[model samples]
Target: MKEWFERERAVHIQFYRRQPVVFVKGEGCYLYDVEGKKYLDMVAGIAAATLGHCHPKFIARVSEQLKKLVHVSNLYYTTPQIELAEKLREITGMDRFFFCNSGAEAVEASLKIARKATGRKKFVAFSGSFHGRTMGALSVTWKEKFRRPFEPLVQPVEFAEFNSVEDLEKKVDEETAAVILEPVQGEAGVYPATKEFINELFRLRDEYNFLVIFDEVQTGFGRTGRWFAKEHYGVKPDIMAMAKAMGSGFPIGGVGVSEEVAEKLEAGEHASTFGGNPLACVASLATIEIIEEEKLVENSEKTGKYLRKRLEELDGIKEVRGMGLMIGAKVENAPGMVSRSLEKGLLVNATSENALRFVPPLIAGREEIDFAVDILSSLK
Candidate 1:
């Protein structure tokens, strides 16, 4: 360890440690520590690098934009931001959009839109949902461990059972402003909502006239084998929040809203200082273009199926669930197994205390999956 790390051991910032190595560079599907030792990258910056790290296209676009305007306040329009927003509209069928600096900011904007559109204070969120850590986003997040220390969060946020239609029916009412959920819950060990549950969300929204917001931050940009996981169930939400893979590594987040809900917010109702800077927008555009040109979504679906099937047959795996490149394998003693995998040079996360999670890049193929399994099989 370096002297800086040793001295900062008692720092106030919370850190998530998975292995002893610190990454300094990344390529298609690998990371190199500062010492130049290489390891296969399976996390993809917690699912942020949909196109892998330091992609040639990304570098090219960002490099070209660095020579031009980088940022302009929301007061003025910029070409890159407008162009990117148009592409998003074409892809998602959302009429309007708002950009923000991070996933938390996008979630906060969604909440504000929901409240303003419905004129109701109470909002419904599902258990095991990880929206973001900001004050407003944290309000609706149901993880007790994350919310415990910050008591008295923004008021009137309600938690409903995940994937339980009956529970949602009982909790949602006329006073509810919106119902927020992750179509495929990522942080909750890759639990996917059933087709029935997805339909129920739309039904309840129609019955109660509340906005439905899908937090696609983890599953969007081809992570879940689709452009958006909501498409899997043929249901469309009033608003959608996405971020993790939107810029492929750059800090950017966005919210898409229906015309009905979007019209309520007049001029000066919302904005961000550094949300849609030229650099971030250009990077996002390049990522989307690469995904389309290379047909990475199809690869995610095919490769992910093979990987999931192989993982299900692995020793000590209790259950494997999820779609596309985003997968979770339940195992006994997940935390210990995760540490053991790290020691063996295969990286994975214990998303739940008893579940091993994998969110490899969309380009990960059978050879990589086989290597991952080989390493897991070696774990005692």
Candidate 2:
């Protein structure tokens, strides 16, 4: 372990302060460290692993794809890519799809589409919002710590107080090319946008010609008890960016656009060399199928209600917020609690200074929640 740590420090950039434990393998909701200690993974790789670790169907599908073809690039048409697009269309209700490698790339594509289609530069984002780390996405992100170092990002982007209809009213105008936000803010303590706020934003979009973009990277793909978090508001966005759980553990992301915006996009305007590659598309297709076949979205809804009820009963928690399995509990010291939980064989993480986030796999049920809540209760 010490040798591994030293090697990491010497070879890798200090991008993240990772947990002390070094996991070797995972199965279902459990992870095993080098010392063979078992841990219940309640965070699901920060909501990226939709079907948990090494799900049989997920493995089988990907293995089959690997035996045949992998990356042929966007220059050629691939069946898996088109199949994944059709699945997304059924679930996302968008007219066009643009595949990408990661959530940040998906956000970049969405930002480009918004600007090109609307022919405007200014954008409106909300406080506590985390879009992505890419330049255009970073410009819309609200955290100063994430944005300040990358000084002079894509300009003219403004921030409105989250869920504040009055502030949003003041921020948006005809000059705004787009208004981008996560329906549920994951990094900023799992705060969800209110229906009133969404309704008002769409009303403003109708008045001004700016596009509305939803960054559903963390909250999409059954994490929020729905196919996408935008469905909670019952309003369709002009553009939507998704990733995280899209291909479970595999790296796959995409941007979906409304017909109006799709018409404005030209082939040469934007392209990716490995965007819609075969292996990634099959992985995503299998992920979607697993979510559908197992009814994990329903499980997320039912089990989440139970989990929230259990969390609310805990003594030390101030409040619990979020929909479905995507949740955050307000606590006294999030990082301290996370460490303590890890010591007790439960894997959880802190989203912010005082908030502990839980985004377990969509397949998680009442049994798993009970075990997690028991650990939490004991800690409290």
Candidate 3:
């Protein structure tokens, strides 16, 4: 397997730091490697598979869609695409949405829409926010390491302190086209935005006429115990970029836009070739239905609380933060601890130098939570 991986690396780009395991199959909250060793999945493909691997409904729907149709460009309308868009509209209460192939593309679309609609060039983004790696999204992302190498990026981005209403007020001016933030900062250790801060953003948006964009790429689709993370604060964003669990394993993303913002986007302004194809659209629709019918949003709230409570009781932990199944715990030697957990048949992620992230599937139960906690407590 190592030889095979090395061979593949020769041909593919070295973009990802992959694990040593070669997974061959997945079902529910578990994955099986090539050797047939079963492991509990806590990361849920980095929170992309909300319903867990190969969900029966997800598979059936995608397989059926495959037989019927797959790729028909935006020039033509497909039923699955329209249905999925309507479902998104109902969930977000937004007038329209533009589909894409990944979270980065969604973020890119939101940035373009904000600039086009408001006719402003500057954007205000919070520190520790991870929008995406694309040029437009990367400009707003706060990490110096990711941004330094990609110099001469989209310019005139101002950084504000996360959860600091005062700093936000100071930075956002009339020239600001948009303010982009993750309601729950996933890569920055699952930090959720304070209600007070969110309220202030809405106030600023109304006062300055700049759009407020929520980068829900990682927190959407019941990851935060709600339909959308912004819902927790009772605030609506002018544009919302979402992907991750929306398609349950398929590469699909979308930007929900209010009627006002949608009106500014003229035809031939922004487009994706393979975006919103039938396969991805059907998979997304099925994933949404399964999340609703199974009541996974409520489950995320209940299970996540239980998991956080248990983690808090453990020794050698500094902080436990986040909502629903999206959780992060600060611990020593985070990366080493993650590797140890993998050895014990558990899959988790280290989002930072000291933060261990747990974003299991929405269908996770008490047993899985207990098993994961036991592994963490036993880690040295």
Residue 79 shift from truth in candidate 2, angstroms: 1.0
- Model-by-model lDDT, in order? 0.87, 0.92, 0.93
TM-score of every candidate: 0.97, 0.99, 0.98
- Measured on C-alpha atoms, candidate 1 has an lDDT of 0.87
TM-score result, candidate 3: 0.98
The Cα error of candidate 3 at residue 344, in Å, is 0.5
After TM-score superposition, the amount by which residue 126's alpha carbon in candidate 3 deviates from its true location, in angstroms, is: 0.9
Model 2 residue runs over 4 Å out of place are none
Q: Candidates 1 and 3: which is better by lDDT? A: 3
Indicate which candidate wins on lDDT.
3
Residue pairs with clashing backbones, model 2:
none
Worst 10 residues of 3 by lDDT: 1-10
> TM-score of model 1 relative to the true fold?
0.97
Which scores greater on TM-score, model 1 or model 2?
2
All candidates: CA RMSD (Å): 1.4, 0.9, 0.9
